[model samples]
Structures are given as structure tokens and as C-alpha cells.
Target: MSPDLKTSIVASLESAAAKAGLNLVSVTQGTGFNGQPTAVFELGLPRQESLGRSLNLELSDTFDFDKPDLLPEMTAHLAGEAKRLRNPRPDSYVTLGGLPLAFRKFQWPFHRSTSGADTYIVHGEIRLEDGREHGLHAKISASVTLTFAEIVPAMEQPYAETFIYNAVRKTVDMGQLEFLKSGNRQPVPVTTRYYSRWQKKFLFTETDDNERLRYLLSKVYWLSGVLGGSKPVWIADPRDSQYLNTGEADLLRMAGHEAGEGLMVLDGEFAAATPALMARAAEYQAMLEAALDFTKPKFNESMRSGQANM
Candidate 1:
């Protein structure tokens, strides 16, 4: 990419970030995991430098700088990203059972598995964030099968980010992933099983009205109440809506009901946890413990005997 085009992209992203109350710290060009050109956007809050994130966007070979609408489209996507980053623990998510996990260091632009598995893989780490200074985490190699890859519009960051993250969450929810303080990279297979061809959608997990309410409560409690110093968080994120197979309006309605029940305080599209919600801290803690135990690796008599011999 030419320096002029790079400047234009940075300027547009800066404007979008500012409008969303974020600072565009810098933009750097680097090589992606797939050996393609990548732009890394360093974003931070207005005066809080400690709280920030770096977003990696891979630029495909066929990218055209001359396209008149390209800049606008990229800017629109960055604006949405800015909005998402405004949430407390933007990279973190809560499981159905209340385990809060923070995904980090994901090498973007999926690459083919070198082991000849006929799958595209991206590496990342998911850490347990249970309001603790130190906790368990897993280095993951998440792979998408060829059939499942066809459903993805693009292999780039902006296009595949949501579904990929949701896949990791789903893997954890199904007890297919285990978190440890130290361990080898584990495999998370993203296959056609996650897709519904008839509905033309990616199905991660099934959640009901009561489950949705519990999810919202857990999100606010952990993200806002525990981690964010009681700041309000956006409750109707499209990503969460998609993960839950529900509409954004439905999430907003759920938040409204929770606010009426005094479990949370709503600020338009955002919600903050209340004392009533925090009162269930023990319940949420128990859920987290149970989930951790469920995901722990089990050893049979033979494996235990082998370990004893070693």
C-alpha cells in the first residue's frame, strides 16, 4: 500500500475513534500470520493509557486503493469497532455457566495447517478472568474445516472475528476446552457442525429468555461491577445478539426488565450492575467453580498408572 493511502486510512480511523470517545494511538503496518500485509491499530481510552487494545486487520492482495467507497466502508467498520472497544473488557466474555474468559494475542488472517489437516488455523490464548490477579488460561489453535470456511465471507479480521470468537466460547461451553496455568496449545476444531445451512447462520449455543437474563446479569456483574469500577456497559452488542441467536431489541428489552427488577441500572443502550445483582456474587462464583471443574481434564486408570510410573 502507498503511503498516501495509509495516511488516509489512519486519518479516517482516527476520526471514527474520536467520535466514539477513543483515541487512535497509532497505526503500524506489519506482516500477518499468513504473510500478508496487516494494519495494527492501537486504541486507548481518552486519558487511560493503561486500558487499551491493539486490533490487527489483514489487507488482502486484491485490495484496491482506488475504489471510491473503500475508505467509507473501512471507516464504518472501524466505527463499529470503536463502539465495541468502549465496553468494559471488550475482549472478554462470560460463558453460560458464568466463567469469564478474556481472549488475547490472536494471530489474525487464518493460515492453512502445516500438519496437512486441510484446515485453516489461528492461534490465540483464553485466560480465566474471575476477578483474580492470577488464574488459569489456555493457548489455543482454533482450526476451521474447509466446508465451514466456505460459509465465511472473508478470512480477514473484520469479517471472521465474531464467529471465530464465538466458536471459542462455544468450545468452552461444551467442555471441549480446558484452562490451566501452564499447558501446550490445544486444538479447537471449527467445523460444519457450528453452521445451519437451512437458516444460513452460525449456531454457537442455544439460550432462552431466562438464560438471556442470567447472561446479562453475569455480564454486568463481572465486566462492569467487578472489573470496570461500576461503569455502564453496552448490553445490546450485535456480536452477543448473534451468539445468543436473538435480536438486539430483545437484549435491550431484557436489560429493561432487569432494571425494573432493580438488578441493574440502564443508561439507554448500556447497563450497570446494581447491589441487587452483586448480591448473587456467591452464586456466580459457584457457577464459575463448577465450570472450571467440568473443563478439567480427566485421567483413566491407565493414564494415571502411566503418570505414576513416570
Candidate 2:
């Protein structure tokens, strides 16, 4: 583990403990077994002995406990994350996913050349049990921060924001319509109150537009369920991603993106969340309505005439 990762975990846990109305005693990140970085953050109870008793540990009944540190609750969240991190590494590989953005997948022009920067190869050596040396080679990684300071052309924020908002609105409207059509459920009810809340959340607040857009996009997923329809997208199937570097391709294709081109979307929990699914459903409804409306002239007259004849 990295020192930064450990530090981050400690900080997050401490904050969580504080919010849960628990007294935070100490958060420490230090070197652990095998000299790997580790963080051990625990909430300290005034009545330490009393808190320890509530836990379901093998020794929970063996001690007096004080605070109700939600170990079981925290452990549940960790289990999902750890499962993702330790999924059967069929190819014995792991990945730190990239920031989601639409991008063209570039092939290395040469054996080691890519659209990325040129970096020197790094080397390290490891000792085997027999005292033999095993050499480890590390290539320069793709660094995003290096380009952060580079000056770029100006963009029309107003026009771009308008276009995206219109696109997003179309999706939201669709989901809302679907909900109304269902005759029993709320279309997540985007009235002045709801729209105002969402409008401000995305426009006024210093929030990520992509997140808001995605949240709205997820409305379609929810709308489908409300209307009794579902698009079952797999969270992360091992069978689909069995081959090395294949998961990325599978993910992109499933989401209707190019096989090699990347896409950004929520993970398993986020996708399954009520709000996100609803947003997806809304987006889908918007798309369906838009297509239907576009070809309305061809069917509207017939529909009206058929109704009149009946």
C-alpha cells in the first residue's frame, strides 16, 4: 500500500467516526509487515471497556465495551471494496482505473511509443529464496498532472453548458413522462421544488457537471423499473473480463461506447442505487420519446384517424 492511500483511509475513517457522533481518538498511518504502508484507525470510547462488549468479535463477549464503533457496518462496505480489489486475478493483474472521459484509444506507433509522453525505463532487483536476484522493470506511467499546467485554447462555457443542459433536460423529461404514463408512480417528480433543487445542485453549486449529468442519466434506469421495464447491465462480470485488458473493452461495449474507446459510469453500488437507476431510466425515456416524436408525422395522422373511425 502507498503512504498516501493509508493517510487517506485514516482521514476518511476519522471523519466518518466524527460524523457518526463518535469521539475520534487517534488516526495513524505507518509501515506495516513487509515494510508496506498501512493505516490502523480506531475510534476511542471514553468507556473503552464498555464499548468493546457490543462487538460480535470472537472475543466480543469476553470484554466490557464502551462505544458502538460500527465495525460490522464498516466491514460490510470494506468487503465489497476488497472483493473488487482481490477479484480472481485470472491473469494475475490489477488496475487503477483511469479518470472517465471520452477519448480515442491510440495504438503505440512503435513498440513503446504512444500518444503518451516519452519516459525512461526504470529498473529494480529482488532477491529470491535461493539468494538469486530477480530483476524488475517498470516503464514510465502516463502522467496527467504533467499536462495540467499547459495553457490551452479558450472555450465557450455558456454555449457548451446550454447544449449539455438541453441534452440532460431531454433525458429528465423522458423519465418523468414514463413515470406519468405508468399511472401509479412518481417520475421522480421534478417540480419547481425538485427542479430547483437539481438545478441549483448542478448550476449554482460548485459541483461536477459530469456527476450531475450522470445522476440525471441514471434516472432512466429507475424509470424503467417504475414503469416495469429493465435493462439488465452487468456490474462487473468475471466471465466477460476473463482475458487480460479485456475488461475495459467489455465495459465500453456494454455501455454502447466504442470497444476500445473508454466511457465513464458509476460502479456496482452506485449503479444499483435508487437515485442513479432512476436517473438512467429518465435518460432512456427521454431518448425513446425523442425518437418517437421525431417520426410522429408519419404515425400521428393514422393514430388520430384510427381513433376517430373506432
Candidate 3:
């Protein structure tokens, strides 16, 4: 990408973020592994309010605007994305001690030379100063990508009537389903496309720790409904997935502890792509669990020694 174009795109994005009351933490221009022009936009909640918990929204886009006319179009494309980032849908599972479980989307933006209209995600995050006060003092994060085109048409069908029967018959054959329900827990709810509610508004819920599971179950119910349609699928592959840390990971590290539990669901395409990948991830999960067990005793000891000195 030319320096002039890069400068223009950044300026356009910064302007949009400012107008939306968002802090444009950083923006970088580069090329993707596929050699396509790429840019990453990192945004955060305004700094005026200081809360222990935080939210960061990152967007990655790949474009090709080699022609003169397309050069100017790049700015418009980015501006549209910036607008999306300023708003996102509500899909909360569980909120933690001082932080809420953050939801993010792995939207890979690409260019289409064809004539039809294409739907894209307008991705961003909302911060509630103490939204996490209700759940365990840990981080629980998940990502899902829903397409507008895929979901609107399927809203009237009996989701459970069809999905439950199919899932029961196919559960054993579907490796991803088995993996998602690993601990005898219900399958992870992920949707391919959702009717974009967060695209315009954000609802705030302030509660204590007692309602943790209520929030989780509600989120799960929502996920099951949204993810039941045909075009929208749950993301299950770990490789293409991204995780968000709203200070929980850092807090755990600072206190000589680590996340005891977490989950990452892959989109259907990747999840169903191969059996070998799932097996490998399962193996890695086992190793990680063992490591966490070894570290827990040390963490406990450190806490005990600190308390003794106090």
C-alpha cells in the first residue's frame, strides 16, 4: 500500500472513532500472508472513567485497490467498518468479579469484484464499569460470526424441533459437537448470523455474583436460538480464533495464578474441515490442564505466605 493511501485510511478511521466517542488506541498498515494489503484497527473505551475491567476491539481487513478509482473507495470502506466498530450486538454469557465476559468476532474482510451487495460486521465493544461483579473472578470469552443474509430467512422455523433431532442422531458422528460438550456440559451455542441488535444499542445490567449462572444460562439460550439457523455457524477452530483479555489474564499472572476454565468455539467451516485438528487441540488441552494443576499449589502457597506476613 502506498504511504498516501495508508495515511488517508488512518485519518478517516481516527475521525470516525472520535465522532463515536471511542479511543483509537492504535492503527497499523501492513500486508497479509497472502500478500494482500491489510490494516489493523485497535479501539478501546474512553479513558475518562477508570474501571478495573476493560474492553478492546480489534478489526483486521484485507483489501486490493490497485486502480486509481478504487484508491479513493478504500477510505469509504474503512469508514463503513469504523461505523460498525462503534456498535455491536449484545451476547453476554457470564460476567466476572470486576469484568464481564467479552464477546468478539473474527471477521476477515475481503474484497469482492462482483456486483452484488455483501454483508460485513460492524464490530466494537461496550464497557460497564462493574458488569463483572456478578460472576466468578475470572474471564470467560467467546466469538461468533453471523451473516445477515443467512439468518433473516430462517427465523420462523422450529429451531429445536429440527436441531434437537438432528443433533441427537448426529452427535456421535460430529467430532466438534462431542468436543464442545466434553465435560457432559451442553453443546456450545454459536450462530452463523444474527439479527444485528447491538448494531445500534447497548443494554446495561448491574448485578451481584449470585446471578452468574443465570446470566450464563441466558446467554447459552440466546446462542442456541441464534446459532440454530442454516447460514450462520458456530466457530470451533482454535487456530482462526482470537481471545480477548479484559485484565483477567494479567491480573491472574500478577497474583501468580492462571485461568482455571475457558472455552473457544470454532466456526463451522473450520470445525468440520478435519478430524485431526480437533484431536490435536484436545491433546493440547490435556497438557494445559496438567500444567495448571502443578501451578495451583504454588499459587496457594504464595497467597498463604503473603497472608502470614500481613
Candidate 4:
């Protein structure tokens, strides 16, 4: 898409935001995963005292295929990510504060993707200091992409007012209102406090790793029930297991590790923990004798010859 198209869309979006009573904070342009142009708009409104909530409107033109059915692709991508995280090669290993913490036990309770939108849930856990662990729960959403083909037309009649308004409205309408009703404005600090206290309280517990995992899962499941108005079964179904593949579990584990690292970072405990985590990961990988699998793939001349052997 041309720069002109991007500019027009941004203008239209700003106008729409104004109509919707949202104050525009900033609008910046960047590149998407495939080098396609992207614009991010930061918007929010005053609630009670502090800046109520921050909302982001991200527009990208990274359309790889025209009207592509992204459901399977998104699921496959998550599956692949999970696999890599489960059995990360030495080089591909993720590090936080220089620590090579790994994630474990990934589960996807929900996933939905279309050409327009994508959303998924990831559940896992990461081991922390002194055999302590924490649950990693994420609900990620990749919003709809807006192409130049869309921008040009939107600049004309309706002027993208409906599109922009709906995009911003649905986000707030869905959960933000409920969150305000629950009277938890500063959720990040609240979550951090709970996590820090939990870690400190359990630091000296003699509970086994399995018991720790059970506790983490139980807490997350209960939280989900409270937030979602439905209790998720704590059991792992064989059919659900079928959705995952090799290495996906590894990614799930890595995600968990990342989650644990985030909590530590928030609590100011990660700096002192990195070196030991990296050492632990390296030693664990060495014990597995599976470090060679991370090596780069070699090109096969015979396969490229393409003489229809099959």
C-alpha cells in the first residue's frame, strides 16, 4: 500500500475515534511480520481518576493470500510454536535476564481464527527458584488486517467511521466494562502482589513438583471461572491432546517460563536468578544428549534434482 493510503486511513480513523468519544494518544507507523506497512493507534478515555484503560488499534497490510482461511494456519502456527518451545534446540532456547528457563505442559482450551480475526488461549507452567513454579495463562488476539484495497474505499462514502468505532467499541464492551464493575482498576500491580506473596509463602514448602503444578492449575482455573463466568474442567482430555504435536509442548513450556520470568521481573527478583537458570538449562540439555537436533538443515542436491522418483 502507498504512503498516501496509510495517511488517509489514519485520518479517517482519527475522525472516527473523535466521533466515538475516544481521545487519540498517538499514531505511529511500523512494519508487520512480512514487511507490510502497519499503523498503531493508541487511544483511551478518562474513567474515574487515572487514565482509565489503554487501547491499541493496529492496522496491517500483511495479507499473504487473498481471503485466506487463517484458522488452520493459525492453529498450525501455534502448534509449531508449542513444539519448538517444548524441545528448544540449544541455540533456539529462550532467555530472560540471561536465564535459560524452559516452559512445560502446554494446553490450549480455546482457539479461533479467520481471515478477519484470530484468538487463542495458552496454559502452561515454568519452574522457578527452589523448585517453585507458576502458571502461565495467556489469551492472545490478533485483530483484523486492513489492506490498501480496504483503505481506498473507506476514505470515500461511509468514511471508515463505522469500522473504526466498532473495532474500538467491541473491545471495551466485551470485558473492560465488566472489569470496571469488579472495581479492580490497577490489575497489573494487584496480580504482581498476589504472585509475589504466593512465591514467598511457598518458598519453603516441601511440596513435590507435581503438587506445585496442581496448585498452579487450580488457581488459574478458579481465576478463569471468576472472569469467564464458567468453570473450566481441570482434566486433560485425550481428544484435546490430539490437537498438539511434538515440540508444541516445549513452546508451551517456554511460554510458561517467560510468564514466570515476567512475574520475577515485576517483583525485582530476576536479575539475581538469571545465571543459575541458564546454567540449569544448559546442564539439563547436556543430560538429554539432544543438543544436535538444533543444527541447521542441510540442502539435498538429489531432492532439488526433482526427477519424479515417486
Q: Estimated TM-score per prediction? A: 0.85, 0.18, 0.30, 0.25
**Comparing candidate 1 with candidate 2, which one achieves the higher lDDT?**
1
Candidate 1 stretches with Cα past 4 Å from truth are 1-23, 34-36, 44-77, 300-310
Better candidate by TM-score, 2 or 4: 4
Query: lDDT of all predictions, in order shown?
Result: 0.78, 0.28, 0.30, 0.30
Lowest lDDT sum, 10 consecutive residues, model 3, at: 237-246
Candidates by TM-score, descending order: 1, 3, 4, 2
lDDT of 4 by residue, 113-214 (tens): 333343221222322111223331212221223331222222211222122222222222222211111222211100111112433311111333343333
Query: Model 3: runs farther than 4 Å from truth?
Result: 30-35, 50-107, 110-310
Better of 1 and 2 by TM-score: 1
Worst lDDT 10-window in candidate 1: 60-69
Error of 1 at 36 (Å): 4.4
- Score candidate 1 by TM-score against the native: 0.85
Q: What are the runs in model 2 whose C-alpha is more than 4 Å off?
A: 1-11, 14-80, 86-136, 139-142, 146-310
| lDDT (10s digit) by residue, model 2, range 1-310 | 4556545555555554444444445544433222333343334333542233111011111111122543443433233222322221111111111000110111111112134543211111111111113321111112112222121111111111211222223333332212111123111211122123333322212223343334323322332133213322333433223211234344433444311122224344212223334444445456544533442234467667786554
What is the alpha-carbon lDDT of model 2 when measured against the actual structure?
0.28
Alpha carbon lDDT at 273, candidate 3: 14
Count backbone overlaps in model 1: 0
For model 3, the local distance difference test gives: 0.30
